[model samples]
Target: MDFDPRLTPARSDLAARRLQARVTAERFVDGTPARVVVGLAPLRRGPRGDARLDTEALAGESLTVYDEDEEGWGWVQLDRDGYVGYLPTHAYMKGDVARPTHRVTALRTFVYPALSIKEPPLDWLTLGARIAGIAERVVDGRAYVITASGGVVVADHLAPLDRVEADPVVVAERFLGTPYLWGGRSSLGIDCSGLVQTALEACGVAAPRDTDLQEAALGTPVDLDPAQWRRGDLLFWPGHVGLVRDATTFLHANAHVMAVSIEPIAAGLARIAAAGAPLRSVRRVERPQ
Candidate 1:
């Protein structure tokens, strides 16, 4: 197909209007294959393979999804930064709903600015990159966000959604089997507090960084044996913290073996005991009334 530079200005205008329309309606085209680029400048020689998506790509603002056939694939355009590319038909959905979506798809954006990208998918572009975006809704205990450029970002990398009230255990489940990384905080990779923080934030709850900060933020420590702990309860160690999903299971991105995984509380505690380590503490983030 012949390229059209003349459409650039009109496309830019349409892009701007589209963004405003989505924001105003609080909706976006869902369930479609759209490619939103993550870069600063537009493609000079037209679209091709091996193009890179940089950190400042799309300036962390906008991206475009072009249609492949007649529209030449979903033309994804960013607002401040210019990132254009061709995405597969399976990349997106079509619709204008703001319902919560799972990061069943993988990418590098999250809700909070400080959260880290831990272990992203290898085949997926922009894997292991720290990204920032805002989560729109909470569904099934998970916070779904629209990527900075565009598209929905769910539990893959994450952001705390609401602080009002939440199911911490359910939120924690979003990270099941995630690999542990030091100072990491995304579905790509994550640490103890990163897991807790992301999970809590996704559910609209707030928590501090590190075990100490989280410890200080919670209300008076709940005094109960590990067996009595329930979902949403914070499980801590000297240098670790996690959210209990049940009496026997808790979730965390642990340094013990590194990576997010769920295990029986007794086994986890027993492992710590066997290693001659102390079981840190169990604190619960006060639920909003």
Candidate 2:
């Protein structure tokens, strides 16, 4: 099968072998499927700790492992976004687990041993992470969702697997002030495209991981006229993107401020232009009226 070397984790293997094949195909070398075990595992460009972080894998996310180096790093592709990178082999567990029945909607939530909030947390879940076996239990008049893993999470922080938010911008706004982090997808930190992707995905809208790919594939193109811009519209630059908070404001997880922030569109436009990356295009994602 044909694939872009830059995006494929197994590019080196492809060069060594004349034919290309899917990871699931038997002809593919050292191919195995695994699931991420940590809450968030950094996917790096290289096997070393000093390697540049390229992306991240949320807990229970599937990974297609292509190879493992002597240093214990596995070259893999993240199934959620198809991002390729290296991570420690121990971070993954072989095979998939049961599909999640609910998704964590809060910035972060704790998994407790019982319904009581006083108990020490057994684990922590980030926004967009999925969990299975939801059983509602009331504790001191507050409802909690019990997980199959024998943990309790705040009910308000979870949404049924079938439910999705109506407005992506509203979801994005919930992350205002989140720390900026390159290749991060969780609320602990996030990047420009990560914010957009997470917000859109929470609303049942699919999006890619990087600005360039997102600029090419997401939403219908619109003229750069400010009057035409609406809430939920996406603004793009060479390596950056932001969501329209309204007709006059732009919201983004920006490195300039090192946090998610909202600024006047005119000022944001000038700021990006001054940096030599002029606004490239505007793309509008329709929301229910």
Candidate models: Cα lDDT each: 0.49, 0.83
**Ten contiguous residues minimizing lDDT sum, candidate 2:** 12-21
TM-score, predicted candidate 1 vs. hidden true structure: 0.47
Q: State residue 244's C-alpha deviation in candidate 1, in Å.
A: 1.1
* Model 2 C-alpha lDDT per residue in residues 114-197, reported as the tens digit of each score: 878899987787888877755798878999987766778899999897898898888888888999999989888999999999
- Candidate 1 structure quality by residue, lDDT tens digits, 1-289: 2332322212332333434433233233422322222322223223333433211221122334533345333444422223334433233434432332232223343333222234342223222222344446565666555454454454544323222225656656666677775545455556787667656644556555456667777645766587566678887677778777776787778777666788788888889778776676777666555
* TM-score (all chains, Cα) for each model: 0.47, 0.89
Model 2 misplacement above 4 A:
1-3, 14-27, 287-289
Say which candidate scores most in TM-score: 2
